[model samples]
Target: MENTRVLWLYIILLCHYHWFFEEIDGLVNLALKKPAIQSSTFLNLTASLATDGLIGTRSTKNECSHTGVYHRNPNPWWEVDLGGVHTINRVSVLNRAYFAERLRDINITVISQDKTVTTECAFYQGSVAAAAWATVTCHPGTSGRFVRIQIYNEAYRDVLTLCEVVVEGLSPCDAFYFRKHPGQRLNSQLVEEIQSNKPMDCGKACFLTTMCFAYNYNSDTSACQLLKIGDPCDTTVSDPGWDFYSNCLN
Candidate 1:
């Protein structure tokens, strides 16, 4: 009877561990599936305000100098570098509340490594009204790193003004790591620390924290140090018995 009870307890512990691991995995998958434009790399804008403004994160109907971009040119264009290649799901553009008609005949293009693919990710054909946001979704999605928006040939030359640009998709770092980054210490902004028995336990801790991009686990001490910035590609030698997991963009 004692042996049977022991076996039942062991099974219960195993089931609990499995459930915990699966729950964490599900959360990570949900994060990967969500739209991630707050971290996008803004490029080829007339001013830094395009990126520094509320264009990506907090765009709204409010018309202010700190809310959007104003570019001068008949053929003004802008691009967003998603930092890494991603399976793009959709792109949304919010026009300035004051002069949204300036965004007309805009063409959206996705640029990959060797080729450029055109996408039908725009909702409006002509001009979107002021204080309105338009969404363009790519069916089945497309893989690209750079997404460009251009003001094509129109009868009137209009300056480019954008309240916000949002890009949604799956990230290359959704898998989150390329094995344990051996021998390197990811010394960035320290977030937190916790006791972990295995390297994978440390990885799960890092995955749960939004700011934890990397982690260094000491196998000897069972110490897990979470870091704000780290990349697997940037490997460097550290002390012995230290395994690192890096989820930052390459």
Candidate 2:
């Protein structure tokens, strides 16, 4: 009876909102955000736009034939640049409905600008049915500016296809902090102040408030002060022991 009740509660939660789960630092973090890839700015991994419609936006298409298909003699790949480095948490890939079987044994690699590569799945053998979406949670601390889908068609060399690709992660615009300026405070209004252990904790306080766009934190004093301006650094003066952070999104 207890198990049945808990299951019903879970079902209710699932019906309300779409949820993506990821394990971060040994803790399961719920991802309620959407994909971060910019469809219009995406570039073909190799092919020209005329030959291949491998635009990242098409990956969002529900049907099969709308996907981007890549065909070449050797290894064919597609990637989307997120414009900036991000703390990537999850990657969802939708297989083409028509010949989903051609995508077997593909590789998904995420690379940062610093040349750091985090391979989400190597030689992934897709056994899922056609038009199915597969989601993979990246390792903790996984981050990159570019997400690449490399398909080495060694079998029949038919073609590599992708219906859609969604990258879920903490973008730089989502959260960020700047270094402390010695002896300087900004003209940005202070909204609130609270005790915080780390810069991230202070950032969370700012993120929770709609009016807060920036914050100042003192690591030694554990003081966190949320600011009202979008960019605190613009108005800040030299201040020691106080680090400034702001949401680049604003």
Model 1, span 127-188: residue lDDT tens: 87776777776666666766666666464344555556667664344343424566667656
Candidate 1 to native Cα RMSD, angstroms: 15.1
Backbone collision count in every prediction?
1, 12
lDDT per model vs. reference:
0.58, 0.55
Candidate 2 lands at a TM-score of 0.45
Name the regions of candidate 2 deviating beyond 4 angstroms: 1-72, 114-123, 174-250
For model 2 the local lDDT of residue 80 reads: 68
lDDT of residue 233 for candidate 2: 62
Error (Å) of candidate 1 at residue 106 is 2.0
lDDT of 1 at 85: 67
TM-score of each: 0.44, 0.45
